[model samples]
Target: MKNPIAERITDFIKNYHPFSELSYNQILQVANTCKVIYLDKNEILFKIHDEIHDSFYVVATGAIGLSITSDSDDVLIDKCDEGDVLGLRPFFAKDNYLMTAKAREETILYAIPIADFKPLALQTPAVLDFLLQSFASNTRNPYDKTHKGKLISENVIYDDHNNEIQYYQPISYSTDPITAAVNDIVQHVAQIMSNRRIGSIIVQENQLPIGIITDKDLRSKIATGLYPISVTLDQIMTTPVITVPENLSIAEAQMMMLKYNVGHLCVTKDGTNQSEITGVISEHDVVVSQANNPGVLLKKIKRAHNIVDLKLVRDKMTDLIQHSIDKNIPISHICSIIGELNNAITKRVIDFAIEKIGTPPPSKFVWLDLGSQGRKEQLLLTDQDSAIIFDDVATENHENTKHYFLHLAKIITKKLNKIGYEYCPADMMASNPFWCRSLSDWNSQIRKWIQNPGDKGILMTTIFFDYHCIYGDENLANALTETINNEIENNELFLAFLGIDALKNPPPLGFFRQFLVESDGEHKDTFDIKARALMPLIDAARILSLHMGINKNTNTSYRFAKLAEIEPQNALIYEACNEAFLELLKFRTEEGLRNNSNGRYLDLSNLSKLDKVKLKNDFQPISEIQEVIKNRFQLTYFT
Candidate 1:
């Protein structure tokens, strides 16, 4: 039977060349056996040096980017839009793909089998001519001269070992770096950095780069009283700075930075400290060169002046997350990068809110991210759960101080809402008077929750205990964490309630080892992966850490890692829990990207046999962890 979908794809591609050379009947015959592939943005169709697929591709819609990974720099060479042919080089050359073909946007591709197309090409003179011309010119489309050399541009260079050599094109740098003399006072160098809105200033002696002083140097030295403001640049600056040649490529610069664990590099006449400084390249420069890299997205988030700019950057982050998943990057690594980016975005939103309020907080305040965000495991966009803790004011001026912060919170949450973070459904946000409070008030609220241990109190305890300070005073956040740990140290009742909550959803598998899917709800017949699988691990980590007087480690994986270190008796189980948590997170993130939803509810029917098995294997750790939590807290009495 003829597939209607393949016919529709054929109808679309038949309007474009070399398919255009065939009759409707002939094209339909070819399309019947052709495969249709749907790709999310940033998804790779074929990677460099990957085995040649049996087919070549035509973009039916959206765009495909042909990129070359030269010296760790994935340089986008050409963009193939609708009707554009790609991956054909493999067909003509009988070798592995030289360049990667990635979806630049949500794309649909018609994968025409090369075996079937070859016969049609021989019969159709026009089709034969198009293929020969394209192959001869080393171009995807011979008619388009605009990207003539792009396909074969330094993508196939070979070394003596016959290994493909990655090309490293020189990158642009800031030639005029902000500099200060070696004899300049710390105060003066600080002034230069502030005026230029830069983080580091190169220290020079006789027009040669000598040392470097960054914001971090000042924070750790001057602010910490290790060095005074009157100290000379020669005293405070880091000596024998790392240097690269002026003609350094983006990939090489990134390598040097990573090798040294430094953020800034001096571009010199020669690639050594002995050479004169010609320019400067920072990690930011390397990041900006790659549009889809997480660092670039983070930099963009920081520079975003408005919510619209932030929205665009958030969109890019989505693509970055998708790309990371497609490459099978470790889930923990992906979480850390996305988590940092998310926090940065939240902090930027707060900065914008402060700007809109036309004034900074009247007193010192710290922004608190609650629940999943506090744990730093948020991969997909979801509701906002945040609060503010300002310094205590005089009894007479308490309401006025509260009003200032509440107003500030209102602005921030609204801005975040506009940028795609939905308002907390329970009103557990800064905009709520109950959540936005003075430091003492927050401390008291937590005390009440810990001391009382009621259902609502337990709920609040769960939400607030994982609180991470997104911005503001670190001392204030540390003090709050200290207070919470002190309150829970002797509270056996509180630990019991938390343990009871942790076991609410038992392991996802039933006695027969069948998935215990939701029987009925809006997500009928679907597996509640988040509520059942992920939350059990999160709850166990939190309660177990609380019992051991561990605070401030909100992330489940991090908590488990810490647990493993401290509890070597059960270290294997803790490590197993950590791996299970990561795998579940990866599964949920991939599902979320695939369905464009929260990935909370997973359709069991949609999963492959391998996916089902992988998910099933993770359940044992959840069961084991819950058993440990139960015995530790003596939760049998509570239930």
Candidate 2:
């Protein structure tokens, strides 16, 4: 007898190829033997090593994940959604399934019998080729080592050997650097070098190499009185500057630096200095090209004099972050190194701004980083949130003091914007008069927020509480933090309100185990990774840390680690949360780098099976931690 659901099943299959290639009668015949299966979210349809099912399944609704489990470790391989097919193990020899197929969300699937479909696939060349292509593209069989298989060995994709070869291409050099005429006066040459900070100013005439005047040459000759300061550069400059071609490799550049015992190399259009000076490559540039060590990066940041120079350094920082993740470096060390570089960049911007202003600060003050920067966990370039708190001024001179600091902050932020640190969209920068205030005004504001603790007050508190002294008097920032801490200790209700705010997003998994993706807005159908995944963890960490009277730590991961130590019973859970947070952060950063956005919105359809599993694993701890918070604080009463 014909199955009643056969026509509907064929209709669904006919929409997707190579089923669409089949005649309607053929598709209907195949669908008659199909089984309709419903899977609850997370329910496993097939496990690793299980015998191949005779039927291949097509997703009719929701999503499915294919994963591999070995030695108690599970890795997701691929994900399939509506119209995507799974369970093709029967296509090959009678081998066991290489991966487990599971329902990512509550899913309805149509299982088409291989007996009915194989003859059609074999008869049609296009249909057979399409199936092969689909199998290869699917995330399943990631470990398959055969020719152009879906699963290449994991080592090839993620291990150090593969990443080193893939990410570290040879560095490029600038050719035909600007050169000075040999007979140029000593003072003029000195001015040029100081302006450009080029260690050696190439002396050329008619685009021919002549000599070079480096900082060393000036200090050794003119400064030491070996040669009069009024002498021409030709008198003191080293003759016959070493020249290289534009295509110098990092290895070759380093070799030249060693061979000549020189700090700078002049690159010409041709290999010889007879050609025009194209560019200069310094030893410092070579070092920056090689690695992102903190000492090396810090030195590079300090030497950056302009926005263009700083942007280059910032790009290197991104490379550093990717390298750290690829190498499996400790997250704590990565954060510290990145934090130091970020702080150094800001400090350089301030120093440059001060030089531009051509005046000393009117009074002492502290520059406060108000958000992730303050927390010291900002690995990616996100929004800039900062404020200025100047030293207390005389009542009559208060307005003048505030104005001076605001002007300074404006200059600094402008430079920062040029260097790729986007201005805070909400205008939460030091340039704002409300943010650039004297110490007394800041204190008053904190007091009001602490006493009131309304929605706006809570929002303000969240930003301000993370304040780290980026520049200026550390003591001033410390004093402010002490004041806020004292207020929080006094007002227990404020803690409750913070707790209420922390629980706003809750865990992302719904009762049916489906991801609570954003329903509307610019992020519609995409996961709000920040507010939904990362922020809840951050908020929970902050509230718990505050309740424990811990103020020294600001990073979410560190807070969880400290909490684990303080509360040993919940140590396992907190440690899990910390690990999950790091994984999620790394995932978000990689996604952001790929998509060229903030990495907050994730398209659920694009997640690989392995990525889906890792993400889902993260959710388990999130759900568990929220439960702990609920039980410990009795947060349900407030909610």
Candidate 3:
């Protein structure tokens, strides 16, 4: 006898595909004939070459492994988790099952009758097309050879309609640009441009543009009578001009101009200026197309009347980050630009919050960004880790001043949370009264952590040491950093303690060079690339740099390079660490862009052999640096 739950299953399925085209009564009829099957972990649902069953299965819970068999050996093709449909061979052809289906874990599946589903497939063209495409992409019909021309058929079926997907259309630019030869006299070029009323002319060699002579060049060089008008174009022209492809978008063109601080972009055939000049995109052209230039974005931030407008600007910032990455812009430069923008957004949020409170800040205060944001290395959206520190007030006004800053921190943090920077899960944010303190209180807290030197104190230092002033007075942050450095100079034990903490997580590799994946958790079996690999290097750099009494440098790579220069004996090792850190960051950024996540956890199973090798190479520096830390700090005796 079939379960009564089958009718409910049919109702759910009917809302989604070929089943939707079926008559309500007919769907119920099919559902009533379906069977509900349960399997424990590692149990086989069906084997290859077995006679096809009367129905296919939809995973109700847990996961199933769909695999193909070759010479009696089964190779897993894909893991079908919840909502995945599997085993649909009988409807198309009367053949034995080509693959083996096994339960990846304890699972419940709903099996629908093929006979009843066939009528719906015939009635719905969308359903039939989707089924055919899914089968072609997922099944073992490598030589089935049908549906080869239907590009995006599988995408149409699987892509979620509601997700915000960015459109990647080619940029528009001015075609048929003015050009000249390198040997051409400036006077002659000026005559041609003046006759045509063009402001600039590109100078080329063998059809490849090499330089540009603009109106500014003529005014600054010739009109000022500094350079003779008879001088060759090369004498007055700016060589190695910025070049962009014809397809650059308005947003990209604007970013490029702002990034390089240039007014003209030479449009080349392939964006390299190695080929003939095809067009030009001037600063004016981009400004005309884009209503939200940097100036506009900045003004909007200033004039933002509410959190809603600020949210819109923050969303635009996310788009700009993606654009920067796609344009192959330097990640460091991108981080600085976005950091300033993010800081501006925070400032605006603070202003809006203060306005809403109907009171100005009771005292001068600074908002400090801790951890990655402090280091200016935050490339992806991560948790907010910050603190608020105000000037010490008179005893009479101390409590009242603290209360005002706390309220302000709460408002600012709330707006930040709404803008996609998730609240720190660990409560390590400015909103916490413990974090929102006066300058005197912050100094006292740092002294206690430095003197005590316990696990909690070390952890606090790890978070606080990365502090970069995101908003408010820089002098306050500088004073705090200087006080800490002065204190650290005398506290050799504290530096050793920090070094030991840095060595806690060894390189994530086992004896046989296999990845040391997490044994248990929600992310069980996944490699924690951030914690195990990246953090070790970051922690080491901070500890070593602080010990060297170096200040004002927050970047890990720059810190390591500085360390290398100061300590020539350790130069090679430090240089290797710097390179490895950059490589890992680049890898993580690429992965994050691909999967749309923090890119902290990596799926080792899906990594290419080349990437695995590259990742393993980073472990060498980790091991070497840890040894250096242990030896230099004499942590062996302490451990």
Candidate 2 differs from the real structure by a C-alpha RMSD in angstroms, to one decimal, of 22.5
Clashing pairs in 1: none
lDDT per residue as tens, model 2, 1-639: 666699898878898767877899989989888899999999999986688999998889998887654212344546777877778768744877667789999999998888889999999876765565345334232222332223221211111211111122233554436577866789887887788766777888887777777888999888898988778878898877878766454555665677568878888877577887887888777866666544456677888878788888888888877765665555555665677678889998999888988988888998988788888777878888999989997889888888888899999998888888889999999999989987788889999998999999999998888877878998888788878888888476787788788888877887887888988887888888888888888888888887788787587777898899899999999999999998888778777767877778888788998898899788777777777777767777876
The RMSD of every model to the true structure, in order and in angstroms, is 24.9, 22.5, 28.1
How well does each candidate superpose onto the true structure, as a TM-score?
0.57, 0.57, 0.57
Per-residue lDDT over 68-112 for candidate 1, one digit per residue giving the tens place of the 0 to 100 score: 652233556678888888887755678777678899999999899
TM-score of 2: 0.57
Question: What lDDT score belongs to each candidate, Candidate 1 first?
Answer: 0.80, 0.76, 0.76
**lDDT tens readout by residue for model 3, 121-183:** 777775665565345345222122442221111111101122111222224456988899888
Candidate 3: regions farther than 4 A off: 1-299
Q: Rank the candidates by TM-score, best first.
A: 3, 1, 2
